[model samples]
Structure formats: C-alpha cells, structure tokens
Target chain A: MESIRLFCPATVANISCGFDVLGLCLDTIGDEMTITKTAQKGIQITRITGADLPLDVTQNVAGIAAQAFLEQLGTDQGFAIEIHKKIKAGSGIGSSAASAAGAVFGLNALCGNPFTNKELISFAMKGEALASGCEHADNVAPALLGGFTLIRGYEPLDVIALPVPSELYVTVIHPQIALKTAEMRAVLAPEIPLKNAIAQWGNLGGFIAGLYTEDYNLMQRSLSDKIVEPVRSPFIPGFDKIKETALQNGALGAGISGSGPSIFTLNKGIKTAKKVAFAIAENYTETGIPFEVYTSPINKSGVRIINR
Target chain B: MESIRLFCPATVANISCGFDVLGLCLDTIGDEMTITKTAQKGIQITRITGADLPLDVTQNVAGIAAQAFLEQLGTDQGFAIEIHKKIKAGSGIGSSAASAAGAVFGLNALCGNPFTNKELISFAMKGEALASGCEHADNVAPALLGGFTLIRGYEPLDVIALPVPSELYVTVIHPQIALKTAEMRAVLAPEIPLKNAIAQWGNLGGFIAGLYTEDYNLMQRSLSDKIVEPVRSPFIPGFDKIKETALQNGALGAGISGSGPSIFTLNKGIKTAKKVAFAIAENYTETGIPFEVYTSPINKSGVRIINR
Candidate 1:
C-alpha cells in the first residue's frame, strides 16, 4: 500500500504504584494519522490539525519518529505524515506518544512490516524524548505494544507486554490546565525513603499479580502510590478530592496519569468506569477548570490500520 | 487429632528485587515439630531436641506464635509443643519462620482449622517479630501458605500467594559465618535514589508477571536487586564471586538469602538446582568457612501434617 490511514492509541502511564515502568493503552481516545510513501528521500510532517504543533521535520514528534525508523532501516524511502490529533498535547495522557508511535507503526506497515511492534518502541521513544526531555518508554511502549506494558529497565530498553483483563476499563479526566512534564517532575525529590520504596514495589507486584489473576479486589488494594502521588498531587487542584470521588464512585484505583493535571482511574467494567468519569467530571467542575473525560476499554491493539 | 506432628518448610525471603515483600517455600529444608493437646490451661514447651532452644513458652518462637494464635482464639485449652529443630538458627534461611508457622499451623489444625493459612500469617508474624525485631511476613507468609508469597502491605496485613512454576527449584548455601540481621540492615541507607527505586519496582512487576506466566527467561531477567544488594553484599564474603559462579553455572538468579551469609540461587529445574548447589559448595570450600548446601523443589504446601 502506498498510503495508509492509522489509529494511534493514547496511553496512561505511572498507573498508581508503577511510576516510570507501567502503562496501558486506551481505546476510543487517540489521534488519526495518514502516512504516504513519497519519492523524495526524507520524512515530512505535511499537516497537523486539532493542535498547533511545529511542521519542521526535526521539531514534530511524528517527523522525528519517522526519521528515527528510516535512519535505523538505512532506507532512502521517504514518507509524508498528516496527524489529526484528538488527544491534546500536554494533557499528560501520552499525546506525543500517539503521534510518535503512529509514525513508526504506519511506516513499518507500509514498508512491509520491517519492524515488530516492540521494535517500534525505541523509534517512538526518540520522539518521546523530544516531548518529555527524556527517553522513557512508559507511554510509548503501551502506545505501540497495546494493553499493559512494563519498562523493566532502560539500558537495554527492555519492555514487556502484560496481560489485560477483558473487563478492565479506564476513565481519564484531562483537566485543561497546562502541566508541563518538566514542571511536574521538578516537584519530585531525587531520593525517597527505603520504607516507602518497599511499599511501592510491593503494591506494584500485587497489581501485576491482580492483572494476571483478574482479581478486581486485589487490584483495588494494590493500586497505591506511596512516593510520587503524595508529592505531585499537591500541584494539581483538588487532586485528593478527585481521587476520592473516583474511588467512591467505584474506580478500582485512581492516581496521577503520567504527571499532574490529568487523573486516570481503572475500573473492572465499563459501567463503573463511566460512573467514575461522571463523578470525577462533576466533582472537578466545582474548580471551574475546563476538562474532558474519556472512558474506554483497555485497548488490546495499540496502533491499527484505519484505511489503505 | 489429639496430637499432631508437622513439617514446616523453610523459606527464602527478598528474592533480589522483591526486598521485604517476596518469598518462596522450600520442599526439603525445614524443621519438624510435634504439638499435643493437653489438660493444662496454656501453651507449653514440653521437650526440646536437635538444637539448643528455650523451654519457656514466651522465649520460644513456636511458643510466641502459639500464644498469639490461642489468645486470638480465646481458648482456655492448652497444648504441649515439642521442638525438634533441624533448621539451624541464624542460618539466614527461615528457621524461626518454620517454627512459628509450624506452631500456628499445627494449633489451627488441632483446633478444627478455624484460621486459614493466610489468616495464620499474622499470628506467625508475632513469632517472626521475636526473630527479626519487626513484624515482616515475607518468610512467614511463604512458610505458612507455601509456594511464592508477596506481602503486599502490613497496615491491614495483605498477603498474596503467587503461582509457582512446576519446574522451579532452589539451591541455598549457608556459609557458617555469624552475620546478624541488625548488622546487615545497618549497611543499608534509610533512603535510596528514586531512579533505583523505579528500577526495583519495574523488576518486581516483571518478576511477578514471569511467575504467573511460567516464563523462566523473564524471571531470570527480572531477578535483580538494585537498592539492597550493593550495600549489603560486602558483608558476605565472596558474594560477587559466588553469584557470578551461579550465573555461569546456568542458575537463573542468585542473591543473599534473607539477610546475609546464606546465598540462594533459583534454577529452572531440579537438575540445574543440584548442579548450582554443588558448584556453590565447591566454590565456597576455598573460603575455609564451613558451609551447608541444600537443594529442593518449590514447596507447594507450607506446613504439612507428618503424622497424627
């Protein structure tokens, strides 16, 4: 196929206890992108809609990701990308990741799948680094591999795709306040108490176990962040109350998604997820902050072909 | 049953990345004890054998655990516990845990099994506190519940029993050096780098996922310690060499077994486990320190009735 239309998923990172290592893809919330094979031997971002991002090949995440993929492939083949962003930038829900992952995913598909979905993560992370100021896989991984993904380490860029329970649903509330990744990171301390770290790892282990066993109660119990949430939550207005509201409305767990400003909740079923979404929206409305709520099942397929 | 004899399996706690929260039971290395119902009004230690230990109920771990269990049961009836210790105290294996878990397990069995194996963890922890100076359930949970166990948290005492792969085996080398838990803990800082904490939790999540999926290679990759091992390894002579030797000998992973002095390696099969045990023994023989090596399958049953 010379041209391919793709749907790239948004992802929620730092799921409670899984700070820099865990993430899950979202269905029904993403960006639409079209990539076409070009005779000119270079990558290009021809157009971007719904968000005012740079069009420069080096500046745009899609362009950066596409460049990374082609450079690694050592191919003279060029591609032009058009991104129709549905997930807003700086919303703390892997907005850049969708664009980055989509570029490589579509390019690999158009190139007769030169790379596996997992292989696309490193290329996507090059773009992610431009957005987050660091090459982290928490968002890009899930956005590429689908479902739950764990960034076990970075030296070798080890990423593992975890099982997704069929009934699991996610409700993300993106408060329209501008929470930059750097500003959110600045609030955190470089060191944490060993005791708190132990608790966090324990909860992380439990949460993974819960996913494998499909135990909702265990997931609820294990969904706690001892180190990051306490310090970062203060930056977001009514963060505690929003989390309490979600929990009260039947969310399995709630915590800061990626960084501050966006709060995500995981629920066992769509009914509870929608209830959590409504409750969080109604509660956060008092703050008079413009916010959009999206509820979707855990996306089983990260990036998919829309049309060709 | 008026009188019951029980065998309580030894356990390996920490398991590298799962510090303070994870453990697994062993099949062959354990302690044997007999508890008998008596007309007396409280718990008693009637006989002691195989090792020097206290006859007084309060001083003995078994007695302390029995007291906690009986007190919680609000029972006026009494029992006599005979100690036949096969597992050495201060061996870094779960010697105290075996006794404690065995006491509660045997008492619960005689008392019509009111408490589940999971419920007995708290009572067993009461005895564990006497040994570790803290109410940590890593060893006790596995000793009572068997297989692999994760102590998710302590506030409400959440203990989760994890699935054990059928081929998993453990090899433990007890270097006969006096290494105190307090000293081992002293080497560690109260705080750790947030980056290392993230790496630890990432490995922990991966390790749990590996356990559930029976992925040995994943388990091998995830069995790493970043925070505790660096500071504590120096206390154990030839730790690095021993670990390298284990890895070189095809062991899946190796680390300090609860605290120090005892080194443990996990292997995919009994053959590899025994091979690891023999290699560790030969390597440590050069240290001129007397050592004992035990290789066993992963014990699925924690404490079992040997006779009634």
Candidate 2:
C-alpha cells in the first residue's frame, strides 16, 4: 500500500480572552506525520523523528487518536507510522497538537478519506486528552483548519472562522529554557479578582472589535491580560521588559503564548514585524539566552496536504 | 442676545458589558433647551420648564452644566434657560444626560460657540455628576454628539463615534416604571467569579465583532449579560417575556435598557422593528402596563440646533 503524508502547522492556543477556545495556525512551524497502510490486521510499531518521540503507541499522542479512530471505525487494517517532529516538543506551540492532527489527517487520507474535517478534529482532540490529561480542542482545531478560529461552543464542536485583519503579523520568541506545560498550569490562580475580570472583558471586547474593524490602535490599547500573564510571567525571565520593549519598538501588543518560555508579539505591519522580531531577539540576546524568533502572518490556511 | 434652541437626543448608557463606556443617541425623545444670554455677569439659570425642576441652580442638571461651561470660558454670563422635556424623567433613557447635554449645547450656541463638541461633553458630565451623584460620560457623550459613542477614557474624555450599520433599527419600550440608578448600581455584584467574567468577555468580544462585521447572528448570541441582568431583570415586570417575544418577533438582540422598566431591542430592518415593537406592546398589554414604544434608526446626528 502507498504511504500518505500529512503536514500540521504549529498553533498558538489560549489567545488572550479565548482560553481553551481560540487558536491560530502558524505558517512556518509544525510537525509532520506519514502513514503507510500494511497487509497485517493490527497496527505496527513506528519510528519517531526529531526529539525523542513517544513510544508505546497506546500512550503516544498520535497513536492514541489512531486507536480511537480505529475503534470508532471497527477496522482491523493495520498501518506503520513515521513522524517528522519538526517543532520542538512542548515549546508552547501546539507540539502535541501537530502530531495528533497530523496523524488523524494522514490516516483519513490513508483510509480513502472516510471522515469529514469536523470528525477528524474530534478524533484528534481525543489525543489531546491524553497529552493534557483532559479534553481540550484549542490547539487541534486551528492545526486542522487555519486562520483565527473561535470554538464558540464545543459540545458538538462549533468552530467559526473569524475575520483576521490583513495588517496583523505575529512574532513568537521562544527562550531556550524549558517550562513544562503542567508546571505552567499550576501557576495560574484558580480565582481572579472581580475588578480584573471586568477589565479583562473590556479589553477582550475591544480586541474582538479590533479584529472585525481592523482597528490596530484598539488592539494595542486592549491587549492586556490581568488574570493569566501577571501570574505566569514570573516564570519567564524578562517578560515585562520584552513586552515593554516590543511595544515601544513597534509591536501592537505582546504577551506570553500559552504556558511560557515563549513570548509572542503582535505587529501592525511588515516594517513593524521586522522591528518586533529584532527587538525580541535583542531582549533574549541581552539575557544571554538563545531564542528562536518566528515572524509569520496569521496563517489563514491551517492544514495543508503536500502530497497525495 | 437671541435665544438659541437645541434638542439633545436621549441615550442608553452602559450598553451591556460596555458599562460606563458605551451609549447610543436616540431620536423621538430628549430635552429641548433654549438659552439666551443676558448682560448680567454672574451665571444665573433663570428658569426651567420640566416638571419638578430643581430650583437650586447650583445643583440643577441643566443649570450646573451651563455654569460649568461659562466658568471654563472665563466669563459668567447670566442665562435664562427653559427645557421642554419630551423624554420622561427616570425612564432609564438618559433623562439627566438630555438635560445636561442640552444645557451645554444650548449654552455653547448662546456664548457664540466657544467650545468644541468634545469640550461640551466634559461640561455635560460635570452636570451628570451633580444629577446622578457620580461622574460618568456614557450618557453625556452620546447625548452631546448624537451617535453611537464610546467614551474610551474619561480624564481627557476620549470620545469615539462608532460606525453604525445601515440596517439597524432600535425598538425602545418604556414600561412606565422607575428604578433608581443608584439602586440599580447597588444590586450589581461587587465580586464576580472569573469563569462568569470570561463568559462575559467572550460574549462582549463576539458582540463587538458582530457590530463591526454586521453579523446580526453573532450579535444576537453575544448580547447576554451575566452580571447585571440577572439581578436587575427581576425588578421589571414582564422583563423575560418582553425579551423572548421581541427576539421571536425578529429582534437581533434585546436587553433591559440602562437600569429597568425601559427595554430596548435591536432589529435588522423596519419590518422587524415594527414586529418587535408590536410584540413588546402585546407583552405589556397582557401585563396591564401602559407602555410607549419608540421605533427609530440609529441616530448618527445627536444634538441638532433647530431654529437657532
């Protein structure tokens, strides 16, 4: 049987107010999954790529989603898998999502495209449950379908493609330090002050208004997170300085992406994008930490099929 | 000097999550103020027309605003004022704002128009402070400017006229019951749960996006209030039915206007506007409450000087 290849872009989840609801697909970063059908009636062990990939197909992110899919389909057909782990694992960039979404997307093609995009997203989210220890669709949705998306409702997985302004550019800076996702989750306060919550709503409203109106200035004024960032920023060194310098340099807004070690800045234009990338790089350079800077437009296209 | 007569439209303040920030100027209801300059040097508001007019000019809604405007101009010109109140007082339709804004607007014309529209709003807000026992620009800005206005910041009084969609029509039902603004303020929770706050923010964001994109469906889904409405709605008779009927009759969104008694619905077209009005009227009829319904488009032009 012929092998099928699937590409999944890196995603930025928990975009400010849209915690566990909004996610954006990136243009330059992600992981890849390739699946080749086999004559055997059961799944085979696979080789992992890039970082030390997870063994125990049942416990593995991709393997778990595939198992769920196979159980749902009641199919005995087996397949060999290969993962090109391009994105660093646990970089706060939807690393596990890339693997999960890629596998579902790759297998759908391998099985002659039995399910729809919506079905693939749910099956993929099952894998996220294994990775995060709970059901979460933030990363998988955008990894499967690009651009700015809103999981307005999740019981049936109501996904919406919201309007993204053309002037928007995202600059992600990943510090070389390792911050585990579970550790990042522990730092967040279970309860937030009421006044701060109202302020958050105000900013979130303005931010959404900014998206629809392309009001970059409103986005700049409204890009604040009192509930999450203040608590999480302490773990990431120079978080305040990076945010201030990025805004002062040219970025519209800056904040920690998902759980940190990675900081993201939103720029208004190409020129501002370059300046934001440079400023972020300089911040990491001054701190004596090697960092990766990503400059990409909001990838409107989420998942791409490179080969048939 | 010739008396300058101006009409300032009534407004709805704290449009859901935009508390202390959003207001919309409406037609068919307001205070008609006539201001005439005299040779006397001291600011004296000689007369007022509205019933139960406060005789103490220092604290009078229109009189204080007139005084504030003169003090800012470095001249105390005594002015005789008369306000024909078309909008009933304490109707949750910006009664005080109509008076305050009318005074500033009327005085600006009588004083040879020394202040800009923005300047008048600040003076009007001072009058709002005297009337409502607090300094707020939500009602004043829209009353002075005559449009959908956002009072972004108050120190300098940053007012922005939000772009109004063409197909929008407002159905206002004033149910002839008064809920004191202060009492309404008292009922709001001083401490809100973060989870509720996040839901409010998501709704607010979606609402703003709907306004900009003219996505009526999104706006409908996003107009819910988790904090204010639950407590305040119980004060108004038939509040739930009015909302349910209006939406069923074609309103995009409906909510308690300002404090209580007065409810407003947003509809897509004239047909829906009439339907919403009739539905609200039917609900009021069933409840044995005499109500007045005002059907108007989004009033982009706020204060108009007619027969100056």
Candidate 3:
C-alpha cells in the first residue's frame, strides 16, 4: 500500500490505582494519522491539525515514532504524514500515546506491516521517551493493543491484553487545564508505606480477577486505590468531590485519569454512565474553566487502519 | 452426623512474589484432622501425631480453630479432634493453615456446613492468627478453597479462587529445620523503596492476569519475590543453591514457600517437576539438614471429607 490512514484511540492510563502499569483503551476520542510514501528519502510531517503539536519530525511524537519504525526496517523510503489529532496533547488521556502508537501503526501498514505488535510498541515507546522524560508504555500499550492492558515490565516489553467485561463503559472528564506528565509525577512521594503497597497489590490482584470472572462487586471493591489517588488528587481541581459524586451516582470506581486535569469513572451501564457524566461535570461549576465529559464503552478494538 | 474426617492440603503462601496475598494448594502434602461429636459440649484434642503440637483447645491451632467454629454455631455439644498432621509446623508449608483449616472443615461438615466457604475462611483465619501471630489467609484461603487463590484483602475477608493451569505441577522441598514465622517476619524491612514496590505491583498484576488467561510464560516471569525472598532467604540454609539448582534443572520459578526452612518450585509437567526435585535435593547434601521433596499436581480440591 502506498498510503494508509489509521485511527489510534485515546486511552486512560493508571486507571485510578495502578500507577505506571495499568491502562484501558477508549472508543469515543482519538487521533488520526495518514502516512504516504514519497520520493523524499526521510520521514516528514506534512501537516498537523486539531492541536498545536510540533511539525518537526524530531519533536513530534508521531514523527519520532514513524522515524524509528522506518529506521528499524532499514528503509530510506521517505514518507509524509498528516496528523489530525482529536485527542489533545497534555490532556492526560494518553494523548501522546495516540500520536505515537498511531504513527507506528500507520507507517507499519504503509510499509507492508513488517513489525509485530510488540515491535510496534517498542517504536512507539521511543516517541513517549521524547515527549516525556521517561520511556513508558502504560498508555502506548493499550493504545496499540486495545482494551485493557498491563505493562508487566518495561525492560523486556511485556504487554498483556487483559479480558474486558462486556458490560462496562468508561466515563471521562477532561478539564481545560493542562497538567504535564512530568509535573504530575513530581508530586508523588518518593516512597509509600508498606501497608499501602500491600493494599495496592491486593486490589490489583482482585481487580484483574474481577475482569476475568466478570464480578462487578469484586471489581467495585478492588477499585479503591491506596497509593496514588490521595496524594495526586489535590493537584486536580475538584477531583475528590467529582470522584465522590460519580461513585455516589453509581460509578464502579473513579479516579484521576493518567496525570490528572482529567478524571474517569467506570460504570456498568450507559444510563449510569450518563448520570456519572452529569454529576462529574457539576463539580467544575465554580471554576468557570471548560471541561468535556465523554461517555464510551470500553473500546474492544484499539487502533485500526481506516483508509488505504 | 456425629463424626467427620477431613484432609486439608499443604499450601504455598506468597507463591513466589505476592507476599501476604497469593497462595496455592498441593495434592500430595497437607494435614489430616478427624473430629467426633461429644455430648459434654466443649472442644477438645483427643490425639495428635506427625509433629508435637499443643493439645489444649485454646493453645493448639486445630483446637483453637475448632473452638471458634463450635462457638460460632452456638452449640453446647463438645468435639474431639485427632490431628494426624502431615504438613510440618514452622516449615513454611502452611502447616498452621492445614491444622486450622482442617479443624474447621471437619467441624463444619459434622455440623452440616452451616457456613459458606467465605465464612469458613474467616473462621480458619482465627486459627492461623493464634498460630502465627498474624491474621493472614494467603495459605488458609487455598487450603480451604483449593487450587490457586488470591487474598485480595484480609480486611472484610476478600478471598478469591483463581484458575490454575492444568499442566502446572508443584515441587516442594521442606528442610527439617524449625524457623519461627514471627522471627522470619521481623527480619523484613519495615518499609521498601518505592521503586521495588512498583516492580512488585507490576509483577503481581501480571501474575494474576496470567492465571486467568492461562499464559504460562507470563506467570513464570512473575514468580520472583523482589521484596521478601532477598531479605529472608539468608535465614534458610542452602536456600539460594536450592533455588538456583531448581531453575537450572528446568523449574519455572523458585522461592521461599511462606517464611522459610522450605522452598518450592513450579514446573510445567511431572517430568520437569521430578528433575527439579532431584536438583533441589542434591543442593542440601553439604548442609546435611534433612529435607523432603514432595511433588504433585496443583490441588484443585482443597480440603475434602473422606468420611462422614
């Protein structure tokens, strides 16, 4: 194929309790990138839209990922990419991952799909390293593989696609404020109490089981995070109240999405999800800062080729 | 029913990396307790065997567990328990759990199983607390429910039975050295580095997912304790050599079973399990501390009544 257009869905990383290891893909919002083969001997960003992301291939996440993918294939075949990003950068809903994973996913398709999904993830991780100071795939893995993902280890790139309950829907609220990932990480304590870590280990084990067994009560019980939420929630305005309201309105669990400035709650049904959305939105009433509430069923399919 | 005989199999608490949260039952090694009803109305120990254990109803694990069970039933009827225990105390093979869980299992059956499995676990935990000075169900959960189990939380009693791969075999070497669980627990650092905790959390989340998804490689990769094994292994003679030899001989993963003096290795099949057993046994030749190797399939059926 001379050209390919891919839709890489937005994702929520950390899922409230699992810091740096857990993430889930979303269906309603994402980024679209189109890569076309050109006579030029290097990757180039032809156009960038919907967000003021860098146009330079070296600075752009999509470009950096595409560059890595093409270089890994040892190809001098030049490509031009046009990015129409629906998911804003610095939104904390894996914005950079959508761009990075999309670039790799799109370019690999244009280059005859040479790399495995695991290899593609490696290419995208480089982009994340460029965007953030650290190379992480909590967002990138789920963005590339879809549904719920566990980045078991970053050293050898162990990405696991966990089972997703069919009845679950994701309710997300992205506040207007921009919170950098690095800044969000800086707010965390250098070490946590042993008791808190033990609690997290238990919740992580139970939550994964709940997904496989489809036990809602177990899932709900497991959603309360002991380590990260209490520390990071204060950074996001009205985070505590919003999460409290969402759960009170029937959310399975609620927490700050990714780095924050965005909040997400999981619900069992659409009716409950809608109610959660309204309740979460009502929390930002005094700030006068605009926020968008999105309701999506767990995106069963992650990134996809839309046009060729 | 006036009398009931039950077998509560030995279990591996922590199951490699998940301290205080994960455990598994074994088919070959455990404890057997027999309970008989008496009109005199109090719990009593009629006989004990396999290891010297206290006979006082309040002092013995089996007896303490039985007292709790009988008291919960509001029964004036007394019971006599014969502890033909196979799992050794201070062996780190859930010896206490077997004694405790066995007592309750026999009594519950004698009383028509008034409590659900969850309730039985709560009652059994009391026995473990009395024996070990801590209220933990990592061993008791599996000893009662069988197969692979996750103690999601000790508070409010969340015990979940996870799936076990059919081909998985457990090969355990119990060194005949007495290691007190409380002393072993005391050696652990009160707090761990956050980096280590993050790594543990990732391993734990992946380990549970691997169980539900039946991914053997993921499960194997996850079975290393970054927190407990390194700190406590020095207390167990020849621990590192046994574990190293087991892995070298084709064991998937090896670690301290619960507290130490015993080490367990998991393998994919009986053939490899046998090889691991031999390798582990050979390691103890220098120390000359007596050790026993028991190999069996994952005990899917935990505690069972042989006669009613």
Report the number of the highest-DockQ candidate.
1
- In model 1 chain A, which range of ten residues has the least summed lDDT? A230-239
Candidate 3, residues B31-93, lDDT tens digits: the string is 777889987779889999988888888898888788888788898878898999788788888
Q: lDDT tens string, model 2, A208-255?
A: 666777888877777777788878889888888888889889888888
Write candidate 1's Cα lDDT for B1-308 as tens digits.
29999998889999999999999999998888999999988999999888898998898899999999999999998999997888888888899999999999999999999989999999999998998898889899999989999999998999998999989999999888888888888888999999999999989988998899899999999999988888888888889989998999999999989997788999999889988888888999999989899999989989999999
Clashing pairs in 1: none
Q: A288 in model 1: Cα distance from truth in Å? A: 1.3
TM-score of 1: 0.99
Q: What are the per-model numbers of colliding residue pairs? A: 0, 2, 4
Task: Please estimate how well model 2 matches the true structure, expressed as its whole-model Cα lDDT.
Answer: 0.78
DockQ metric for all predictions: 0.95, 0.35, 0.81
lDDT by residue for model 1 over A128-160, one digit each (tens)? 989989888899999999999999888788898
- In terms of lDDT, the best-performing candidate is 1
**Residue A252 CA displacement from its true place in model 1, Å:** 1.0
* lDDT of model 2 at position B55: 60
